[model samples]
Target: MSLLSGLPLQFSIDVSSLLNVVWLGSIFVFFIYGQRLQMYLIANDISRALNRLKIMRDKSRKEAIDYFTSSGKVTGDPTQRIDEFLDYVTIMPVDMDPRGVVEKVQHITNTRDERVRAEVSQIIPNLDPTKVSVAENILEIATSLNQIHKIVRHYYLLGKKTNSYMLLFQLQMIMPMVLQEADALVNAVDTFKLGQPVGDGIGPVIASRYMQNLPKQVVGKDTVMTVGEYKGRTLYVLKAEGPMGYVGEPGVAIQKLIEEMKVPLNAIIMVDAALKLEGEKTGEIAEGVGAAIGGIGVDKFKIEEVSSTHKIPVYAILVKQSILEAITVMRKEIAEASDKVQVLINRVIEEKTKEGDKVLLAGIGNTLGVGQ
Candidate 1:
């Protein structure tokens, strides 16, 4: 045995060593305790935000039911409520107040933390200006900033306890989806260009203008038809007014147009608005090549069978809008679909409007409870 190993006659620790151990242990305890507290706080904030969102959604649903039963026309107020609910769902954070999160992030950025600041900044650019009310924007921005700050702070703490490389890899994988959604929201606001036409009795004006210049190749006067070519592809357009709850005629019109055009059925694309979850925004767009004819049983069955038989890529571009606001909202989806399919959503009254500049808009849905 060494001499030092046998030198325990003092039976006491050195004061300096005792102080050092106490200091280090205190720090470790504080760090662990602090992290737990922060996590709890974040969880509480998320719960509160979710509760608020649920309340808003419930209120919106009740309002929609009331309006539908009483007014007989789907009004803008109820639709706006739905839009608000969608916005809330899309933007809410998983663990914190988005505004507070963002503010905290901004602080870290100002303090010269480039790595974390970059991540926060990416989400910042994608926020939709139209979604939030002016007052709400102020509060939300602050909340998001703070939440982001907490995220970064938590991440820093985690790095001290574990390897940051794994955390960074996880973030890299998940951030893209979040960024894509944000981009979609921003693009929806920036490039959305429907509902711009204004005039008293504009619908009739549009209908009459279209009727006078109906294309010869298109069959039937009661059924107005327009033709256009987009991206070196030919397109046939048809529009008609039928009785309420009439979704059959549009399918018939499509068959007639297909026969007249002599184009292969497999190449055709169909676009229309669909009733979606209240969490989906009114003008949100989804693309899939399938028959868009709406209604239960026979009507939908026939259209689906026809498309399936022909091997046609029938694409449906559905706008997530209320069924009661079908006419206006469905029109918007048709226009968006046309744009997406690289076809024009406009009508040509004269041949002066190039074929590439026009697109076919089919207003398809149960016309039940529709019209002025």
Candidate 2:
């Protein structure tokens, strides 16, 4: 303060200017600090969301194991603890491709299914295959719901905290689809757990119920293709061999009947449930062209390929319902549609082809809680 202050002839300082500068510098630092604080908050929220996701995944995994524990007949012993194995299990995305995708998607689903069945077999040797399938479907849906909820919630919270209008806008835009899928997953799990017939299984039930009463023989892929005399045509009815829950590789079954059985199929008719748009009445019947199968398009691909190659005209008879109804408990309207569809099938067969001509009828859908 003595020597240095005196020597400051080279530099000059204004006290009032210095004070103002210090104030401005402080303000600048605080502005930067505030910006960093905002960034930290956004990042922390996202991190917390991801951590929540992990917790949900682990929780669902535990729940699945607990479900197996409660089913003594399935798990061999209900009291015994089983190690949780499905944590972070990878499920493949559905293939939306029109061609050359079934093998890839099927490999993933088939491998997982085999692994699940094997695990069940290992844990409770000689366990019923049907129970294992049910557990697998339920576990899959539970996992899906957990994933959807956590992801959508993460974005939702992030948008809210940051007040980012665009981010929130986009999230709002897509949340309906996310919610729809979650609802369907929840419905499917409930339907399976309740042992109730789902809307998707109605068409398959009719085909299965009718086929069971007829004198039938195995054609291909364990699909029972029966020849029945309808009007003048020898109607060949095909459905995935069931008493178990399966959508029965209808694509391959049709391929076998067409490419292998090589029966002179004059017309091809398929039946299944279809998703109706909002405002459309449930259980409404719609008849059109093409295979009425809902999946990753592998089965649809096979049907289209074979039908096109064989020059067989394809006719579709569909029962319309909401996505929830398709997976949830079958509604009374849908249950009644079974009889209506049966009559429609008979009329389609009678009108579509000539007498003495051979026709192929494939019932396509998950045959859960359905007989024959």
lDDT (Cα atoms) of all candidates against the true structure: 0.39, 0.72
Candidate 2 structure quality by residue, lDDT tens digits, 204-229: 77787557667777765436667777
**lDDT tens digits, residues 213-293, model 1?**
445232432244566544433455544332121222455556555554544543444445566676776556565656665
In candidate 1, residue 121 scores what lDDT?
30
Best candidate, lDDT: 2
Measured against the true structure, the TM-scores of the candidates, in listed sequence, are 0.33, 0.75
Q: Which whole-number lDDT from 0 to 100 does residue 130 have in model 2? A: 66
Local error of candidate 2 at residue 112 (angstroms): 2.9
Weakest ten-residue segment in model 2 by summed lDDT:
78-87
**lDDT for model 2:** 0.72
